[model samples]
Target: MRMSMTDLEPSRVEPEERVVILDFGSQYGHLIARRVRELGVYSVVLPHHAPLAEILRHRPRGVILSGGPASVYEPGAPQCDPGLWQAGVPVLGICYGMQLMVHQLGGRVDRADHREYGPATLEVEEPGRLLAGLGPRVDVWMSHGDRVDALPPGFTVLARTAGSPYAAVEGGDGRWLGVQFHPEVAHTPRGREILANFLYRVCGCKGGWSMAEFVERAVPALRRQLAGARALCALSGGVDSAVAAALVHRAIGPRLICVFVDTGLLREGEVEEVRSIFTGLGMDLRVVDARDRFLAALDGLADPEAKRKAVGETFIRVFEEEARRLEAQVGAIPFLVQGTTYPDVIESGGGAAATIKSHHNVGGLPADLEFQLVEPLRDLFKDEVREVGRRLGLPPAIVDRQPFPGPGLAIRMIGPVTAERLQRLRACDRIVREEIRRAGLEDRLWQAFAVLTGTPTVGVMGDRRTYGEAVAVRAVTSDDGMTADWARLPYEVLDRIARRLANEVEGVNRVVYDVTSKPPATIEWE
Candidate 1:
């Protein structure tokens, strides 16, 4: 892929233009980063103990200390570089973070008389910089045992809850603030507003970063990196891959070959639909029908991780084969593009959590691969990817379709993946998709899929006893596929999906709706 002089121009950002969060291994560290991004300013998370020199290199406009489980007084607890506050950067601290600030700055902290776990009320003593526009009294999410007993020499009370006298405080320096409540999570009514106040007012950020700006930078960077080398993209037609492919295609033009891998486990007509969308938009497309290859490899692997690995390896093999075939025609395909997102990596053991499972691109790739991955959306979340897609002028239908796993229906098929089960699932899934679209709620959901539960249920079909597979319909609304809540689809829409699955699909005897959230149950059953 080659770019003209105009296309190759570099993108730049001024130092001191972004926010950074020092993660003390808080369960909510990523949430804090996401909240900052939602405010239209860039933010990043670093270990609480990250080098002050490294932190200063970003020339951050502001820094935030994420709440953690450790007590400030405990030995070996994560310690911040005291120079962080001394760096002349604005700082805000969350729950345990608040305690750490006070403890390190010469104030006392010990076990609280009454610990606040879930929710609490904060009464404002003074509307500090962080709490500028928020009213006198506001509800906040709190979870901590250690409380700040006294103010640091430069600190004064801003707000307090029943359990702690210094729930929120501001240092004599206008740049420092602390709150013993989680303002990152949605549970706090004015969490976003309070954070916005710190980000815009205290930090002096102009707040305009977005996925559009991201694409504007990425296209040029990819162009420079690839520098006329051939690229092969695994286009899954999902938001991530599509957006990734579109971005690379923009950078390299004809040098980018997009292959839509037909994993056979996909929903009915997905291959044709994807082909039409990309081809219509002028993408150089190659359709590989590898359904048999994928299904054969998934013969008896019941474990979800096994299935994910098998499918991921099979994907690499197919791409490697395609790369060899194209080698004679378009040089070497040095870079392989897959639309892998950050949350997927984090959930798959990239960030804080232990290994959940191998996200096909992150952990599931075969040890031997033909090309380096070009995942433009690796650091972005799902919603962010969608915005990038929209910026690239992809079809709304292609960009709006809720995400599907890279392993396809193999992961969605809980029991065993077979041609028969796949077909049955495809039929039920089609009904679910059609009904959701007909109800005009398709865009309202993050993802809605049909899963084939292993166990079969007995039912009387036209007076004859029949036993068939049970199916579960899952729909959720999530921002970045991080934390999700099950979509409260209208019962009338659910009724249509259930009725059609029971009558027309001919496979499912019972239909169940999954109401569980992500913590207890993932969006995909497998």
Candidate 2:
């Protein structure tokens, strides 16, 4: 739990040195911010209509306007602060953003005769500050229905494609730039370079921000906030919660109590595994067997969000009861520590990010919860958290553990959660995990688990045919949990998993592999 002073002093950057991304509800808005951080500069995503003063309060080095689904001429299309141009900061606009900027700056933008939807050849006519270093001819990804027809007072074309006359343009003082293509997507080969030019060449950023700097700032901040007070941590044995507990343990030492809730939704042997790991680290670990309570809370719930909220509410009640019991021994425990990551915050409807799903730790918590949450890793991605864990001196086994959702198998099951179904799914999950690791892919893949699809399938185990439940196996590869692709697991690995599920796991007569990725289907079945 103790960290060396050397690990705590890495020459951090001030939080004010960052780029502010004005989100126009583009699916790529969060990705834009991720790419900016990948370039070693901090960035944040705000709603398009954020107050001019609020956007400037960050002392942003630059501003980026994200593309949206709406057209610029639409009745109620999102708009940014007109004062942004007068803020004297560099700004880059993309897609619909470009059209909006052009329209608001006294330029004309109209629907194109033929909208560009995919790959296009960019013929760089000028290669101004934003497009500099990219070759004269580059392949870019474009998706838009409108194009700029006329230039604003001080604007000129920088590049053009077959579909649009002004694919890229620069205006007034070289501080305003616009591109009709999305630079944050992987489809654009040199997109990262374009973003780098804006961050470094245009905004003049120092590129000093990093995960190491984040840890240095967070440790002291947690200490100052929880000084002379006790905190309880929800230690779920996953990297997020484990790392969160480790950081809090470093800050408050023995005053930090780690609670492991056995909600009966966990995979087989997981409870034992967690107990061994943290207890060996000398943590103040306590286990609560709230299996019956969680099941009762989720008895009739078949909807994913409802089950999540039920489990979330049930979890808080258990923690509050435990907190009261511990008060007599430790005086008081007012804070609940969680390993909530950036993806969790955004997906839970934080700020301009859409609410894709309500994460158990983020959106699932009860409104009247007693403890204030201390989330040290709230703004970091999954990969960044592993780096922080390594910096905190945690072992590789804990640092590199694949992600597990907070709602656990409850979310993995496709229907009503029952004791029979829970055990069957747990066994199936163990087989999948075992086969994956036996193939030496446990570390290679982001997550590999089993889902109990409530639908039954006809199968034959002996001389006669039998109908039993089908189990779906899911495995994905991802850098951050925000985006993922179906892992191309070896056929042999897949075969072993399927065979084990059918032969060893009772009630699972058929097995299937899930090939859907994150965009269309999340990592978890729910």
Tell me the alpha-carbon RMSD of every candidate: 4.2, 4.6
Tens-digit lDDT track of model 1 for 333-389:
878888888787777776444576788876787655657667777767777788888
Model 1 stretches with alpha carbons more than 4 Å out: 1-16, 70-76, 81-86, 106-108, 113-115
Each candidate structure's TM-score, on Cα atoms with residue i matched to residue i, is 0.91, 0.95
The 0-to-1 C-alpha lDDT of every candidate, in the order given, reads 0.84, 0.87
Candidate 2 lowest-lDDT run of ten? 4-13
lDDT of candidate 2 over 195-314, digit per residue (tens): 999999999998978888887778788888787799899888999999999988987899999999999999889999999989998899999999999999999999999988888888
Best by TM-score: 2
Q: Which stretches of candidate 2 lie over 4 Å from their true place?
A: 1-14
